[model samples]
Target: MTKRTLYLFGSAAPPVFDIARVIEEAQARGWDVCLGLTPAAAEWLADGLDGLAALTGHPVRSRYKRPGEPDVWPTADAILVAPATFNTVNAWALGLTDRFVVGVVAEGIGKNIPIAAMPCVNAAYVRHRAFERSVQELREMGVTVLYGEGGFVPNQPGRREPYPWDRALDAVDGLAPAAE
Candidate 1:
């Protein structure tokens, strides 16, 4: 089975529930799945990690270090940054991995792991020069940023629709040759 590590960033609201579903689908197709949550996001999605773990049958991680638990750090074939919030996106684009989610993404880049970033934010923020610059920087550094229409939610005012799952899966498939 292809190992898939889903890095879930919840720096904002709306929870990336759709992205969660995509990861779940990937898991069903035999990809080993794991999740990383941001501190702010942990508050937003109460029990969400448990639900994701239940669906994926893998532990959801939110910390950068667990001194005695290295086994929890499963290797990954690809990394998906669903609902990439402004804070997380900007931080990552600038090489700031102080948080768990961003840190995993940094590791992926270091190891040449394929990465897909799905940006979720308001039109105003999306139009911001700084934000646009950050996205460009990410692309320039070889991160594939999935483009899609965004919407407003009660908790997540700038939530985008789910990214194209088929394409994401295709990316994962392209990562390796078939096992004979």
Candidate 2:
């Protein structure tokens, strides 16, 4: 059977969130993982881009290619936006596509590709009216917004919580069968 492609999008969050683990686990489950990062996340992970590319056997993408540039990555069977930041969620809800990650996800919704988003925002940020509305909007668009007590619980500002990467993977796993 051909391997399914999973495009994993990330935003700047706690440095402790191990993306390598997420990639490894997805590979173990038979996914060809592709990494996409918001610009800040790309900068934060700049030192490890080479290793990440080697791990996924695909280039780690941050910025959008210029017009006429060839698309390098495989078409995605599903998309997972883990460690999705407050800014990304709001931008996605408002249909902002200045960044590559958000652009792909917004288009993914239109393409009917299964999507799972695990947000990593702080409690204060979650209290913003826009944040809740964004989550609701994404859910209405059929993007699984993994939030609340069982998913990515908002932590106090200035504190880091263990991101539930496994739950994000589970969300994708559940979608994979249907995608096929």
Candidate 3:
């Protein structure tokens, strides 16, 4: 069987979350993982960019490619936005494609690609009215949002809770076949 391609999009959250573990888990589950980062996330992980690229055998992308530039990565069968922040979620819901990560997500939705977003915002941010609406909008668009009690519950301010990376992976695994 051909391996499924998974695009993993990460945002700047707690610096302690180990993204390598997510990659390893995906690989073990028979997925070919590609890493995409929000600008802040890329900067936070700048020191390990090369190693991550080497691990995935693809360039870690944070910016839009120049005109006529050949796309370097394979088309994704699934997309996971782990550690998604409040800003990213709201922007994505509002159809803002200003950044590479959000652009891919917006396009992925248009293409009917399966997407799982695991948000890591704090309780304070979760209380924002936009957050609820954004999650609902994304769900209406067929994106699987891993939130609420069983998924990613908002943590207390200035406190970090364990992120449920496995649940995000499972959501992708359980997605309906890509729309033809």
Clashes of each: 0, 0, 0
TM-scores of all predicted structures: 0.78, 0.96, 0.95
Identify the leading candidate in terms of lDDT. Answer: 2
Off by over 4 Å in 3: 176-180
Candidate 1 lDDT, tens digit per residue, 1-180?
A: 434454444455464556477776766656666766777776666567688778667776666776675666567666767667788889899888889899878778889888877666766666667888888888888887765433222123344543455665555555542344
Cα RMSDs, all models = 4.1, 1.6, 2.3
| Per-residue lDDT of model 3, residues 1-180, tens digit only | 578899999999983258888898888887888999999999999999999999888899999999999999999999999889999999999999999999999999999888999898999998899999999999999888999977899989999877888888888888734332
The pairs that clash in candidate 1 are none
**All models: lDDT?**
0.66, 0.91, 0.89
Worst 10 residues of 2 by lDDT: 171-180
Q: Which parts of model 1 are misplaced by more than 4 Å?
A: 1-11, 67-71, 148-170, 173-180
